[model samples]
Target: MAKIMALDYGLKRVGIAATDDLQIIASAIGTQPTAHIWEFLKTYLAQNQIEAVVLGDPKNLDGSATDATAPTEAFANEFRKRYPEIELHRMNEVFTSRIARQTMVSGGMKKKQRQQKGMVDQISATIILQDFLSRRSNGLF
Candidate 1:
């Protein structure tokens, strides 16, 4: 079975996560600098069977576009055009960063370790994928 991948795209980096082939577990993979995301994906996709991609969609409290919204959407569009064979999905990402931080704290990560931006990004991607998996399993997606 193919896996489902999730990405949390930030201006500086893109966090990556993926499900097991059984689509039952989501794990944080790593991160890539924004400039190297395409290169990273090219290699990753070639090495893995990814059935779909879940993209973090940023939105304001009122559902207005956040500064990152357009960029995320643009990236999603480009990804769709570049890899038309794979399915793509967008998920509301409000408070994911905050949640990621809290997760680090709860996981007993040291302050300095939790402060690392890349760690939060990877956790955020994991959260995105886990949420997607939950909703899909519940037939809400």
Candidate 2:
């Protein structure tokens, strides 16, 4: 099966994650500067067979779109225009960053490592991918 990739997009950087070939596990790939996201995707897609792309959809506590929504949607539109063949999805990303932080602490990561924003972003991407996988498995995607 082709792998599914996820992105936790930020203004400064984008976190990347991908499922295994079997699509059974979601793991963090790395972070890329936002300015080079398209370039990074070109290289990544060239080397990997990706069937779909999942992007984090930031939302407020009351279920409304947050301030980050517009930029994310704009990015998604550009991504779709660039890669029309690949499927794109937006998964709700409420509290994924906090969850990632908690996960790091529980997983025994050192304070210094946990302080790295890139690490949090990567982990958040992983969380987004995992959520996508679960929803998919439950026929909710």
Span of 10 residues, lowest total lDDT, candidate 1: 114-123
Give the local distance difference test score of model 1. 0.95
Range of the 10 consecutive residues with the lowest summed lDDT in candidate 2:
59-68
1-141 in candidate 2: lDDT tens per residue? 899999999999999999999999999999999999989999999999999999999999888988889999999999999999999999999999999999999999999999989999999999999999999999998
TM-score of each: 0.98, 0.98
Give stretches of model 2 more than 4 Å off.
Answer: none
Whole-model lDDT for model 2 versus the true structure? 0.96
In order, the Cα lDDT scores of the candidates are 0.95, 0.96
The per-residue C-alpha lDDT of model 2 at residue 83 equals 95
